[model samples]
Target: SSFETKEEQEEKMEKSEQAAAAFPPSFSVSEIKNKQRRHLMFMKFKQEKRKQKLQLKKKKKKEREALGDKAPPKEVPKTIENQRVYDETTVNPEDEEVAFDEGTDEFCSYFNGLTNPKVLITTSDRPRGRTVRFCEQLATVIPNAYVYYRRGLALKRVVPQCIARNFTYVMVVNEDRKVPNGLVLCHLPDGPTAHFKVSSVRLRKEMKRRGKEPTEHSPEVILNNFSTRLGHSIGRLFAALFPQDPQFVGRQVATFHNQRDFIFFRFHRYIFKNEKKVGIQELGPRFTLKLRSLQKGTFDSKFGEYEWVLKVSLSAVTVFFKMQEELCCLI
Candidate 1:
């Protein structure tokens, strides 16, 4: 390549400065290099901004596709509707026995030797009037059950006392606004604590009479509309409240209603020996309970479906024998 001489370069620079100055005084020749650098930087900034905008647009498109413009329809499961009958001939006396030895290795054996399983119904230390009343009512409903105020006793202390006293279950009534709104059921020795929502509690007087007033001697139980794993757990819970070998000669019958995952419990005694053909006696209280939520290991409403909190815990097993007894009557 041919190189320009110093005199030629000087002449070219003078000509370029003259051309720039002829346009406007504000367009200074001395600022030409700085202006070129600024222009290049501005172009790079614009390119980066355009790329970011395109990336955002793509992300928004993906989100729209994933969510869909319209939601899909929900699915409903089919259910069976029928009345189940229990034959007296199928009752086996030996099957009614609950062997605590099956899973009692880790816990003490006080409950194993007890002839009657007891339930302790209690409220929080500072229980409201409604809670206290509910506890009393529940104790009456459950056979061999009694009520005691917690009196600020910690769970660590309460649990050991219950075990020592041969109590099979400890029921805690949680209150809100002076009304029983929640229940905590803990199986003794081995745990699998269950939390349940309490609603629509009615005494016998509060319920609408369907037929003749129930007899006083006959005992009855009703399990209404409980289905699935949780339902099974609840049904067993109800069974735990009663004696294993109940006086069936008095015509004790537990009616379970299993429809749409709702459980209704009615305990009464059935009699069909006399000319009346069929008769019923209210053995336990009438109440409706629905399992809308639960927590594993322990009962804490604040961590379940009704609330947003996380807590750790364990398992549930109690009603294998009751379930077998009711299986024959399931329709």
Candidate 2:
């Protein structure tokens, strides 16, 4: 390779200088340092803002506590707006309309005559495995209860058999997609059938077992509707439904809840080292029964009304007898 002459080298340097001038100047170390400083300052500003926000939250929480406003409002899910007909008048008027005398006298007499109310828990014909097991567990919870399979027998057929078996109450477990989802409770010898939604069934065996030895104390019944004045009567009515057997000496606790037209029953047996120290062991199955409707007598479709019938039916006969006595004295 031949070396370039001085004049040629000078011309090349001039061309390079012209080309460099056409473009902007290259970044300097000072400019780079300035950019980094600006970035750090921005980050610091953001961090300070976040810290101030945290402090404000803490202050607000303290203020709320000092004001005695501890509990925040519960957030209920917004119901989906679908084109489903809920108005019974438009969909089925005859089914929704309840006659004034429909569930009155019959409901009164049926519950009034119930001296010994034994329940028969049966599953629907072709019930799923879970539903069959659920029915068995439910029978264990209720006193004087028996479990049976429907065997493709219709309600009409099953009712007579239930009556013949001397079962005062027939509880039919309805299954959906192989799970128990609904319960049909019927009174024997005539009417007032109630359909309830069954959900959240957790068996005792599924519960977390404790290390402590099981207690032998008799189970206590807790009725949580005790806040209201009329809660005592409701509690007593519920307590009467269960049998006080002496054979099972373990302290079994049954909590009954009547909230928003729904009945939730939680049964547990206490495992106690002594009377002062106790731990709970769930007695198989938790029941959440949502009241759907009550039929007047013998599961009549026409008399199916969405009403609080349990309390009313239990008190009806007493009210009727008192009225009759008052009339007799007046006469």
Candidate 3:
């Protein structure tokens, strides 16, 4: 135990020495935050545009339906006609548990005078083999200040970029992102709260009209504040749900840093209907994708999903889908 303690202290000293080897490069936290805000702004604009289109469509569909009511049968496909009249909406009601329903765990409290540390955030734009690698040279410069990372950039998630931003969950940014066996949440029992949420600066500005904070916080604002803590717990939730295959619901289960890289793991999934045919997905405005098959598998006689997993990556995937003989005749 004495020897192990000495070795541990030596390792710590060595890491500290390396962090000090490089003079702290100054970067703007405000600029990064602003960029993040701008990206969010565009998302809002895009969503509103989609909503307008849907609304206009609904109106047209209703008018057509009324016109059809007066006419004979067999004008248009009933399925297609019905789809237009209904306005598709997803309404997420606010969570009932807002006020920290239970007493705070001593470990999970917020602290001030935070350090600006450097850690390798997950970013995808790297050599294929190099994608999964972690940047180890991050350090805390000052208390409650900022984090300085060694890497030039971070990765984006394969899933919706919004999920990365809207989550104000359990992100314990330390000097290193690598989790030791048990010390990941060491500060959590008594950590300072810093929540992150996706909101337009325009929205925030509009809400306050002109003040420090909004006069009356939006329901989402409350959720955003609460969601930061959720970031802390997402590991458990992610583990439970997508333990073997991260892409559980046809949506890519992944992790990303806003300015950094994106990591999508446990990717081998066939939930999407057309696995035999190559497909493309626009993950975000920034990234596009093509799936390459690494190995063709025996098709499930009933389901038609490939039994073999592909050696897939955001880059560096080799796809080889067994061509369909029946489709060849049609082609």
Candidate 4:
């Protein structure tokens, strides 16, 4: 035991020497030349860090417990979205202009309960594998939705046929390399189309511990964190895809949750275990969508007026300054 303690002290001194070699500047495990020494040092460093973190956490818990009901509120961590600049476009329900715009938008017919939603879910020319399955899963989630083959037809021509068939929305899933990558949602009859970049797709089979297949009953729709005028329009567009009355017996919910401009779609089924307890199960087909552009008219990329377009360029500094100036004026 005495000899082991002496060897351990020597190792600790060696580590201290290595640290001091780069002290008051920088030191990293990778800086060690010997691969074995590097691995050993890194592991020790990680263990120390983890130990300190746990000790701090336990200390905090003890402090909270000591104070009991008088404990100070927990500190809120800072995040980009929480610390975002004030958005002037956030919809105010009391604003008469916003109210009028909502009441008279292109989606008014559906909100007025004058027309039922019939959605046409189709894919790009000759969709293969996962793309086809994705479209089929989407159809299952949306009530009154039909999945159709593109058959090498132009979207412009398809839009007219969809309107004639009294379809309220035309959804086109664009695939690349046999993977679903883009989405085009065009409202029927008049205008306002949305294009989204699709990513992080997980099918029913890919999910772990997912619930059984969803039923034919309409699932409740939930739109979260869509606050701006553009967001409101997008929310309304999604809302119009389902019928006005939801079938509560299904106990299923479809959620479109927006965070940092990315929309996450989730389907879930809930069951009540008791009066105060509830359990939820995920029903598959998860995906994320980021708005690429919002056009004023139907899917006409050449001549359509864009309400908003997400532009990525090498000259980001210039664009950032321009946006800051515009925000200053709005404020």
lDDT of 3 by residue, 1-331 (tens): 5657887999999998986453232443244457876566557556766988999979877877889877445566567425544323312225344234222332222212122121213322222211121111111101111222315332122112323332212222222222211111111212222212211112111222222221111111001111333332322222221123222234332232212111122111123557576432322111111111111111112433331233435432322222344467679
Return the lDDT, model 4, position 318: 91
In the range 98-183, model 2's lDDT, one tens digit per residue, is: 32332343334333444565787888789887888888766665667788777887787788877897767788899888878898
Clashing pairs in 4: none
- As a whole number from 0 to 100, the lDDT of residue 75 in candidate 1 is 44
Give the alpha carbon lDDT tens digit for every residue of 55-159 in model 4: 999999999999999999999999998799888889876789988998898988889999999999999998998999999999999999999999999999999
Ranking by TM-score: 4, 2, 1, 3
Q: Whose lDDT is greatest here?
A: 4
Q: Candidate 1 lDDT (Cα, whole model)?
A: 0.60
Q: Which stretches in model 3 have alpha-carbon errors above 4 Å?
A: 1-103, 106-143, 148-331
The clash numbers for all candidates, in the given order, read: 19, 9, 52, 0
**Predictions ranked by lDDT, top down?**
4, 2, 1, 3
Q: After superposition, how far is residue 33 of candidate 2 from its true place, in Å?
A: 23
Instruction: Return the TM-score for each candidate structure.
Output: 0.49, 0.53, 0.18, 0.81
1 or 4, which is superior by TM-score? 4
Better model by TM-score: candidate 1 vs candidate 3: 1
Error in Å for residue 220 of model 1: 5.7
Relative to the true structure, how large is the alpha-carbon lDDT of every model?
Answer: 0.60, 0.64, 0.28, 0.92
